[model samples]
Target: MHIRQSIIDTSSLEGQRISQLRAAVEKRERGTILASKYHTAPLKIAKAFPMGDALGVIVMDVSPGLLSGDRYELQWKIGHEAHLFLTNQSFTKVHPAPDSMGGSAIRQSFELGRNAIVESMPQPVMLYRDAVLESETVVRLEAGAVWMGAEVLCPGRTLRGERFAYRSYKNRLNVYDGEELIYAQRQVIVPEQQLLSAPGCLAELTHTGVFYAFSDRIKACHAECVRSTLEAIPNRSGHPIQWGVSLTYKHGLAVMAAGTAAWLIQEALAAVWRMLREEMLGLSPISF
Candidate 1:
């Protein structure tokens, strides 16, 4: 795969840094390949490696982290029967945003052709004191398409005693099958405005993780399997971790976990991912 450089005309928006990445993957007789890719500064794909039958691509950022007024736009197009696993290099560090600009924003969209599959698993996000972030993701899946995504959120620099020091964090996700909207979720966390340690809120948990699997192949049996697997998972870290699994209204399942450590949440989500990959794709556990 060749990385194409594109120039963005940022003459209008008052010197705010805007980065963009557009990529497409297709399936051929050999295997899934990166058909085309274009990226601007602060976002690039060095190469696409093979992960068994699927293609793995890691999104890289040249900048230290997201600063005030920074915007990232990512779009992915997956051809029929293609499988792509997308991840990032490291944690998404969000620095404090100016009160005027509000916060940094991330906009991502995915278009999956028939029988296509995409797994988007990025690393955890770290919010600094007074940091603000707003993220939105939209996915459009055609017949027989499958989309899996997971996210881990960290309050702040916990070791620096900056937990819950951020100003606000907001995220919205929408998934559509053809013209029908199947899933919609909006989450907002304002540490300074709300009582995050309350019973109804995050309480004692400092980190949160969410995993979502959506496909037309999802069935009642799959939901049961996920539930049983989650129940059977042991807490070897001795950390208080809480999790739950739920089936969507149709053709989907969600796993949510909250814990004191990021690794605890990651381990729980990895277990669910392995189970789903075996039951749905008939594939072995992913190596990375």
Candidate 2:
């Protein structure tokens, strides 16, 4: 069930400069790339890596870095029976916006066909002092498709002694099964406007990460096994990040962790990802 798509653009966005990239995988003989395109500037796709039948590509930012008024639009399509692993070469950084009102924006869309699987794990996005950012992500999955993704947000450059100094941050993620919306996550942070360290807020935690492993085809036994595996994670007081995993919907499970160290959250998420990949894809863990 393919839907019509075009080269995406954010022309209505401020600054007007747009970079678009698209990629797809389809069957033909051994295989075929259904769609792959790029525009003004794009997150360059590097060499393909081997990971079973999945097409692995390393994502990167080719410019000095994102600046105010920069807009990046992306599309990813995994055709029927296709597999994709999306990773990044480096952590994403939203540089400080010189003009308070001029910030960067990223909008992306993803589609997965029947029996398709997509694993999207990228590094944290560090927000610098006075930085402003807006991001939205929309994903469409076929009934039998599977999707796993993880994201981490660092309050600021801890190494530079920066913490929650950013002006404003906003992100919205929406997931859909065909045309039916399934999950949504929305966040808006303004460090200057409110005390982020109060009791219910971050409580001085500098790093936060969330990971999801979902498929409409999950079985009762499989889900129970996953639940049992995730529940046994020891809550050691010395660990940098405290993490937990819980069943979300009938077909999905989510893990979220927060800590003062990035590597701790990274290690925790990587461990959970390994368990999920082995169970979901029957594949060995890929190095994080």
lDDT of each: 0.86, 0.75
**Top candidate (lDDT):** 1
Residue-wise C-alpha lDDT for candidate 2, range 166-253, written one tens digit per residue: 8889988778877777778798888888888887777757788888776886555555665565556666576545566676644667
TM-score, cand. 2: 0.88
lDDT by residue (176-267, candidate 1, tens digit) is 88879999999999887899899987788889999999999888788788778877878665678888888898788988889998878888
TM per candidate comes to 0.93, 0.88
List the RMSD of every prediction in angstroms.
3.5, 2.7
